[model samples]
Target chain A: MRRRRLVAGLLLGLLLGSSQAFACASCGSGGDDPLILYPNEVDKIYVGVARATAFKNVDADGRFSTSGGPTVKDTLTLAYGHGFSPRAFVTGTLPWLRNSRQEATQTSLGDPSLAARYALVMASMAEPLIPQVQMLVGYKQSMTHSIHDSADLKTELDVFGTGFSEAKLGVDIWFGQLDWLAGAAFNLIKPLPHTYDGLRYEPGLASRSTLTAGYVFSTACKTTFGANLLARGSLRGDGVVQADSEQLNHSAFLTQDWLISPVESWRLSLSRQAAFGANKNTARSDGVSLAYLRSW
Target chain B: MQYLLRLSLCVFLCQACSTHSKADAPAVMPASTEGVASKNGTFFLKMDWTTGPKSAATSAATLSFYDANHHQAISVDSVAVVPWMTTMGHGTAMKDQKIVPVAGQVGHFTIDGIYLIMGGPWDIRVTATVNGSVDTATVAVTAP
Candidate 1:
């Protein structure tokens, strides 16, 4: 009888210690627990680092070979997500970047992004098999100068940001069974026109789409596979349109997520981008990223 | 929770304090005094700066062409100086700098308004029209 009482006391203690873990405010009970889109009541903070190396340049004709050596870029980011309501959240991210190729290397602070997301529909309440839909709006502000010396052959490599501020409108849909999940996200990115250093330039519109599929290995672990497509329009510099600047690229990626506790998780991703099928003026690269997130 | 927070803070601080080492971040390659031979080996090009490169600032440089033996100066019809960042694979803006032939000086040209734009290694590409043919040579320099 004493041993039974001791076990009961321990169970009660655990329940009291991690009440926020099992009870997400959005889902009254534990019914809407998806692998990737975990709607929780707590705020989240994330730190991530990514590295990408470009080994070849895709020419205008879509040929996947170039004469130069590899170029590597590293990015370290800190992000925060704040949930103001049960179905709405806002996020912000700041990044530091470094780029190196051959004998030249540079490091600088990159752009910061702010975004807000709202869940239009929750799948569990309406229909368990249906997908949850979320809408997002975001803006990325350029923090670096847009100036470049045209006489320097590699001037573009030294600059930090894309040289233009961009706005994003996007949507995400996620659906899953008990052990498998699928998701799709699409974002339209529009860069604003800004004049710098006596030159007026406006970048064209761009779009990114990603489709993801995941399998739950256990209650605490999951693995995901995804494909991404990015398309960009022509850029106009000083009232002159550069038609050859448009790009279309595709990449495939794999990721693994491990939930260490109710309030902490870790994720690792690997990706390979190829220059094929209408790709133009872009580099073929491989990338890897690791992230750690904590909630409170 | 307190321990986790402390751990996160420690990780961030350690990462932020780290920097690239010399082996990883190579030093700039200065231009060679021996000069670079053109692609066809018909002429050689040497670059000398009156005012060297400064980050985000304009500077000036001179280009002189020589024969294959690197001893005799050879004159060309026209010279165009293109400053390139080879790593980033783009050229600097022309700005107000135009390649001008030095008066009464054979095989010599001057370029002004040469902006490096950033602190890194840059390639100065010289394209000259010699004997109805284009001969190109490139020299590398670093901007402060």
Candidate 2:
């Protein structure tokens, strides 16, 4: 009798706890919502785990290396709605790893972001072409503590600064079973005056554009395969002069997904980036992951 | 005495009436083989069931395949069922029901050859046991 009562109480508590956490009264956006990094794409919710490793070399001989060295990151993304409803839903990516690189003297947890996306145009059934437009805005705050004894390297590098704010505008087009999506994003690093000679220094902003093609082969099995090409470039600046300055940045990635079950999936992805023009550098990374998802 | 006699007659008549109704009633429809399709050298066995009005009581269906020459059966452990609604535009629900290793009263099973790596003529058996009543059917499929 006692054990039965205890079990019942525990089950009741769990039920109530989840209901409270996932339920919202007025539909005001909450933290539990899915995060959207890509804009104007398919109408599907993705909840899965992913781990990625990035390797980068500033100079050919490894003068400066920004390899996160097998840093594990998981993502939860949600995309919903058929066509142009002003209200498209999104929110949820929290980075759990502290990014460390050989170039940086000290290491700490990198900035994570929270963002929301809204669709501008909806797909129409009459027309064969379905073009979707959307925007995403996110902010990442830096929380790394300085390792330098004094504010000595403050002017040299913007250490212990408030990180970056980003915005992306994108469009997605669908033709039959194939989906094509492209987007451009801008990242602005906030000026840090306290660390940089009390002179607010704004690092060159980073800009990126992406093109993705995906196909739904078996709708019943919910299996999808796609390839994505991402091009990232840094805006050139007139003031900064370092040993090796970056002028162009480019990267491409390919991804495949198998829906093992409705609530579970396995994914594989690979990417390579090359830096050229005024800047000469190259990097490559590959990763595979499996995740289980449950929705209320 | 007359009242007792009428009550006995009513009981006998009820038994006789139920016997005929039971005879006319449908025998639990046996499970059937619908289609066998192959993709990338692996065969997919599709099974259909006549799930009378009682959907909950129907536990689960099993598919078993046996080798022709050896007469030995090998169970395909990774059988999955994807539920699709006939309603247009309705999203399909896919579920994975891997066979649990357990002993059962009915040893017979249903098997499809599409999931086999090397395919040829194979004996297929399907069993749908519900509430102690076991209904089974078998078919042979040639995989190319």
- The fraction of correct interface contacts reproduced by each prediction comes to 0.05, 0.00
How closely does chain A match the true chain A in each prediction, as TM-score? Answer: 0.81, 0.53
Provide the clash count, candidate 1.
17
For residues A153-232, write the lDDT of model 1, one tens digit per residue.
33345556667888988887766443576777788989898775565767778887777777767656777777777888
After superposition, the stretches of candidate 1 with alpha carbons farther than 4 Å from their true spots are A1-37, A65-70, A102-104, A145-157, B1-90, B93-144
Tens-digit lDDT string for candidate 2 (B54-98): 111222444433222232332343333322111100111112223
Q: What are the models' TM-scores?
A: 0.62, 0.40
Docking class of 1: incorrect
Q: Which ten residues in a row have the lowest lDDT in candidate 2 chain A?
A: A23-32
Chain A TM-score, prediction 1 = 0.81
DockQ of each: 0.04, 0.00
lDDT to native, each model = 0.66, 0.34
Tell me the TM-score of model 1.
0.62
